[model samples]
Target: MTSQPRPGPAVFISAGEASGDQHGAAVAREIRRELPDVRLFGIGGRELEAAGVSRIAGLDELSVMGGTEVLRRLPGFFRLQRRIEGLFVTEDVRLLLPIDYPGLNLRLARSARRQGRRVLYYIAPQVWAWREGRARKLQRDCDRVLTVLPFEGPLLERYGVRTEFVGHPLLDAPRSRAAAARDRAAPGVRMTDSRRVIGLFPGSRAQEVRFMLPVFAEAARQLARRHQDLDFLVARPPHLPKSLYAGAGFPTAGAREVTERSWAALTKSGTITLELALAGVPMVVGYRTGGLEWAIGRRLVRIPSIVLVNLVAEAPVVPEFLQDRLTAERVAAELEGLLGERAAGRREMLRAFDVVRERLGDPGCAARVASHAIELLARDQESPGRLGTPC
Candidate 1:
């Protein structure tokens, strides 16, 4: 009998949240398009599953925000980590592609490096915001780091990390939707329909939703009382149960659809702020967490602004309320100034958003990421010893 050819190498992807799942799925599709027979597997969510990645674990078990919240789920995370490490062995995973979720992915990268697996980190951790040492850790553990932000490449390179600016993935989203919204309501022209929509984006994690949804709802109620034509829509994450949004007193929809129709938004800080900016929605950003998390975060975060839009714009393009300051009344007050098409704050924010978009680079971010991943895999195969050393 003829000996069978050896099975091709498999890739393990770890995308620990909703946004990462979307990015991971896009990259996975692009990867398969180039290498149809390559096996893709690991931890992700519904999007990854639909993209043909064999998930060993789901985001439901892994997605949590704040240090204190993660502590509560520590035992489960440890178990999942061990399970993933085992999959690396059994599945013969040659490459580890980690997308964000630095908390767990960083640990896994270290483990994979020890096992002679090459690691390519995507959507790099916000080390500039906090724990700046993680930049060195990423350099030590990852073979290459792909960043979405324009400035992150130079920052990571300073730490001697192999870095690439793949451009912001948000730009890949259809601009026509946002463009149409803007066309419908030009800078000086109010909506002829006499109705305006406000999107309330609570965020993807359970902790974020639990902490932010009620406050957002209350803000919406306040805004509703002041303006009769204003309508509120909640951008609900698919993973969260409907009951989580049940008493929020607003109609719930997918984030993209809500963003496309929004005149302005009350949003929780994080990637959603960037998404809202991309959609040209003037937004008031807010974030709240458990007391322990807030106390610890306030001390650790190095940057003055937590909002991504402001960070990208390199200016305070939108109002941000965090921790103790994130009251519904305060959010409503800030949002009130952004309610009109001709509102000064709204017009100025939209202009800043335009600058933000221009700086984000062109689209095809996922394709570039996939190309790099494949190149790394090929190089590893040709000279395994080059990436074999553990950090």
Candidate 2:
């Protein structure tokens, strides 16, 4: 009997941040399901590990955010990149999938390409948001790019990058299994009898927590005062301490810390909006950052929508409260509307969300990405000197 052709090509993935890790993990799992013998390994966090990916390095261990933070961690980042680049040369990794953390991942992709490895950028960078020129470099480096946004494809095309709009992964996952869960009756802290749950997601970064958590807590207090019967749950990432929320003044005693349990999430922007949508948990999204950061982002951001649900749905299905507008009063009002099943706004939003969820395509995004990587590997081997065509 043949030895299964030595399993398939070895594909390496690198993802940073909680959202990237989740998306990367989904892709890795799908690849395994599609090609049972495919060799998959990566540098990721708990999400990829739980998805059965072999860890080359823990992404969380190397995470640094914001311009100033990244500058502070430059030496360590360089060290990690060198180690990753060394792995590409010595391990002979045929293909590389670099998920959203464009700064670090882009550099790694460039290094991998230099070592003659095919690169597929899963969850392409938000180049359209700012630094649109990155598209040129991406086209020069990567073999293929998979974008979840419909608008991103054309932007990448201008730079001659090969890109595909893989339906948003949020549309693909199983909805949160938790039923109507209402066990809380107050805002600062309260207990309820109903199973209807409200998700509060401050964010993954400490800075975000600093800026948003207190507002979120105050909003929850207001929400509890008005509703008095909704359960509040926080989907805490492993990187954040449970005490992180305590100082923010959101009662943590009865509030569930849903690391990997229950469903529905009230999260910051990015992938969580999509996750909450996929989970079928209706949410009111909110975000807050430093004034300087907001001003800088405003000048750079291209899109009008901040919520991923709106971006994926290409319309507003969920209300987004950002910056100064993201207050306890605003959050409470929005949450009240969503939790109020009879509210027409809530009905309309949920109805649109149902349609959006179906559009996410299939649940095997990571697998499809994996298969794509393997195919690229084969083509690369057939023509070692060819550069991939831009999208």
Listed in order, each prediction's TM-score against the native is 0.97, 0.85
lDDT of each: 0.89, 0.72
Cα lDDT tens digits, model 1, 191-294, are 65678899999998888899999999999998899899999999987888899899997899998889988888999888988888888788999989989888
Clashes of each: 0, 20
Error of 1 at 303 (Å): 0.5
For model 1, what is the C-alpha lDDT against the true structure? 0.89
Error of 1 at 324 (Å): 1.5
Error of 2 at 307 (Å): 1.3
Which regions of candidate 1 deviate over 4 angstroms?
Answer: 176-178, 183-185, 389-391
Q: Highest lDDT, which number?
A: 1
